[model samples]
Target: MSLIQTDENIIAQMDSYMQRVSELAPQIYKRRPVACVNTFGCQQNVSDSEKIKGMLKKMGYTFTDEPIDADFVLFNTCAVRGHAEERVFGNIGTTKQLKRERKETVVAVCGCMAQQEHICDRIRKSYPYVDLVFGTHVTHRLPEFLYKRLTGSGRIFEISNDNNEIIEGMPLSRDGKIKGWLPIMYGCDNFCTYCIVPYVRGRERSRASADIIAEAKQMIADGFKEIMLLGQNVNSYGKGLDEDINFSKLLRKINALPGDFRIRFMTSHPKDCTRELIDTVAECEKVERHLHLPFQSGSNRILKQMNRRYTREDYLELISYAKKRIPEVSFTSDVIVGFPGETYEDFLETLDLVKQVGFASLFTFIYSKRNGTPAAQMPDPISREEKGKWFSELLKVQEQISRAKNADLVGREFTVLCDSTAGEGRLSGKTLSFAEIEFEGNENLIGKFLKVRIDKFTNLLQGSVIE
Candidate 1:
């Protein structure tokens, strides 16, 4: 697969279409056109929707939180789990009535779910009211697609295979002023049997280090206090790149930038996580003292079946090393409770690992089968009822650990970036360790960093802003 940069010609075509759409929008609407861009699944999809919104804003469209109030509605979808796809379909079904009530409403779907041929066929055969459908690779070309649909092009579906190109310089209509989502890379190389991300997102490709550094500098200058470097496997960054840099080196580069901002990343594969990365997290003052390493299963046999290249011992060793280097570091993780062949004995190992690590929290799920994946074809004798029981047990164990961990934090002080309002006369923010703490403060504290003392623990950490 050859790496292709989006050429100037395509960019010019998109610009022309953008201008046409902007000119045509006023003629079609009596008032300002409003769009509802609904996002599903991961942070990557959220980032994609922000870019779509940016393009829509340029084309003279404002936004709405309700689809019923929208002249145009776009579903930025996810295909990670069957439930997410079902939710998207249910929401789309509701929009059919809206389309009927307003004949001119432009309804569209895009992102990972739209990349699948089966999903596209279903939408075509059943959902005739939908105007356009595009895929993960052509997000930068949304203006062109929207223009065609507006000009009476019937039901545009553009789910082409992976184009192996990284398009740069798309405008972003970010959701917040304080936290910025910066995608350092795109796609996945690991084909874990339980995941459809690699199939939907395509092969791994890293953005140029210079481009990333430029974006980071711009975000800091824009007054973004937190920068989240996003990817399927962030540790796999710099692969297939010309630079000698890797994820750890990249972190150090961003940490060196002059700012009071904090850096965080996610969904790290244990196989690609290195000692250098852990040490860099320990050493960098600007980087958050939190690591979200996902150890999906604890059984070596089940892990091998899942095609997660690392073993339980390997994961434990990394945790041990991380603890030795950064004693106060907090960890969050993802765990699957019931695999196709997982036994109660295998699950005990998972419980053991969880107890050993003492994680801050866990994102736990029972394995969901995906079509066109290797795991789906495997023989299974276990029942969903049994899986449900196992899932409950895992949740119980994790909850206890989490409460104990939070209780230990009582009386400790932390510098938190207040990001949102929790309730009346309350503000919520995250500590450098990525802990959510709600405190008594005014709304003016929303974008500022302040010292807070933890006085209690309940569902979340409760604190008071230091005077």
Candidate 2:
């Protein structure tokens, strides 16, 4: 089957979603509207915020960085960690004071946090001042929700926890014109013992491969030079689909598209990091040479407890294979410092694995007990103090490794996508290997690709543009 074929019903719904936005535009523009959206969480939430901004902009809303200055204020939230949820509460509380200052200002909250039943109930009872509350599934319903609020319906709540069909053709207001996010699939089926994603985000649902390819083509046409395909686990891209196309095939199709743009994807589970996918990354020139494969804990005992379905040996083998195929490939990973019942030896194993892998970087986190997850009920005997110490030690080791790895790039010339200008005559962009660098360049270099030579390393790689 060809890549262009998709379910007619799904396409029709996308058209309907866009049509509703168009219809709501005139009514929304009747009054001048300024919006401020504070996005919290992963790239998926960022992508959702972009669509929200697009719909709001289409309805004649301009943006303000200050939430107090906006006629409409929205929080695209995250529920992945306790700290993020706390920040959401803190920000939402501030909005209540803002509402008192500007009685006409609309305060709304949406995303993964809003999808939780307890979170919805708490907001309804305590945060009565919130104008609208919705979930991830019904993001396209913002226009309808706003219409209800404007017509004096008071507080609006529209949260759907179902694994709803993917809504395509929604308007997008990307953060950058040159770099974009394209979601190949939604939700996760991998219910890792420590995760709440499968519960809140629902099960896996892949968009038609054709739809993804078409989006990439359009992104290129729109002058995007980089596209990152997003998912909870991109390696499982086509499992639920009827089509024969898998992640590797999809990558090949996007790589073949007519464009000078670079391609990247993220959050691969070690269990699903197939041989074909690894080889495909090495083979595709447009694909970035960096992979973010999360090995939460290096102890096989902890891995089994977390239900990761892969052992330390398995993960090491995969990394070894990738490095063998592409010698210069850099790897980054996520590690949770204090998973329930993790022993000191388990933590040591993690440090040992860090040394063995020599990762470019690590996103380390203290294990936060999500209420409904299996690990929450497990024996979490580890104290906060111990977790803090372990976290610090782990970070110390990873930082040293990262510094050494970056130092190795000191004399290298890399093609950097000139993204923006930093203060004091510095231009900043990222290498194809995802090394962020600050270099001296003209302001006009923003949004263009340029070669840069690495000269020094500090907080970020300091460099100069090679003429």
Candidate 3:
């Protein structure tokens, strides 16, 4: 079979699987089967799980939060960090007893972690109770895999290589009603030495702009208050497409859509970020005034080692331009404190960059090595103890910066989308700049936009609705 299946062919195949599952489900399941899908990783994984749940729902499965009460359990895994993988394994191990108690219960593992050969081998040998194992490429074939598992096809595993196809029209059972995740592109072409996303997610391929715009319109009509455009690196979107479009052009199209919703995207590659993109954000009122550009490392030498393709100076230049264009722009970034072969001086460079940026918040990591990545094979003299200390130091510095940033917002009023309840009578939401604030309100205010006045900051910004 060809690697890239046509969308019509895949859709037809899925329809067949849906029919077969419907036929088999009545015979096998006494009542509606309850599925517990535990997603671990990025928003991409969460979006993938939504589609998985959509398929399971078509197969007559009701959802549950508890695995013990579930007739089907799926672990949508992550390969970003070793700690994440370990947590997935630990969670999977807990299901062994559930499988023992309910022998008919189906256990499946899928996603980036399952795409790895070693992870599959380990699951096959160590966790024999897992009935179905598929990879990132074959997520669209979940119904087929589940059908085979149900029809006495013992322990199915389908981890095919990347086909570089963009499959659309898959049903989705989203987790939220207020916010929606719309993936504009998939996979990464950059292949930073310390990362495993390109290896597992395959090559970069963007969804056609028309499809994306249609989805955005539907999201707006569905009353979605915010639409988060997802990608491995969103700035690299519109590559490999036939249209004369790029990320900025795409944003303009979406921003032109009639809606009260806000636009947001993430993990923008600093190497690919451009003046046009920054200008687009400044001009587009719908796009949030926040950029989550991951610099990874501040030292040019360390950046060269990691193959991040941009220096601290280049990153700062982009930041400078963004700030000039949008004065209220809030920035968040990902930083690695202790990369391989990084010295104390290199660490200081990272800290210096953090202070210079004054990010609203930061997501810091201590550099977890992945097996297939080039950084894993590099020489590392830094001890785990030393890395831990450096990690703490970075966190302390960032906390001070974060507190100061939040402090500046005090007594200021901003419009925020109330998305969730905080405590009993309190509610939590995010400002246009992406800073979260908690305010006192009833549950009726959950999905509505409200004006909130920041009163104080203690860990989080405490506020009151300006009624």
RMSD to the hidden true structure, all candidates: 1.2, 2.7, 1.7
Runs in model 3 deviating more than 4 A are 1-6
Model 1 deviation from the true structure expressed as Cα RMSD, one decimal place: 1.2
After TM-score superposition, the amount by which residue 134's alpha carbon in candidate 1 deviates from its true location, in angstroms, is 0.7
**Tens-place lDDT digits, model 3, residues 1-467:** 22223489888899899889877776776777789999999999999999999888887888999999898899999999999999999999999999889888899999999999999999999999999999998898999988888888999989997567878898888888999999888899998999999999998888889889999999999999999999999998888777789999999999999879899998799999999999999999989999999998889999999999899999999999999998589999999878999998999999999999999989999989999999999999999999999999999999999999999999999999999998889999999899999999899998898999999999899999995
Candidate 2 wrongly placed segments (more than 4 Å) = 1-30
Q: Rate residue 284 of model 2 by lDDT.
A: 92
Candidates ranked, most accurate by lDDT first: 3, 1, 2
Preferred candidate (TM-score higher): 2 or 3: 3
TM-score of each prediction: 0.98, 0.94, 0.98
lDDT-best of 1 and 2: 1
**lDDT of the candidates, in the order given:** 0.91, 0.87, 0.91
Query: How well does candidate 1 score on lDDT at residue 76?
Result: 96
The residue pairs that clash in candidate 2, if any, are none
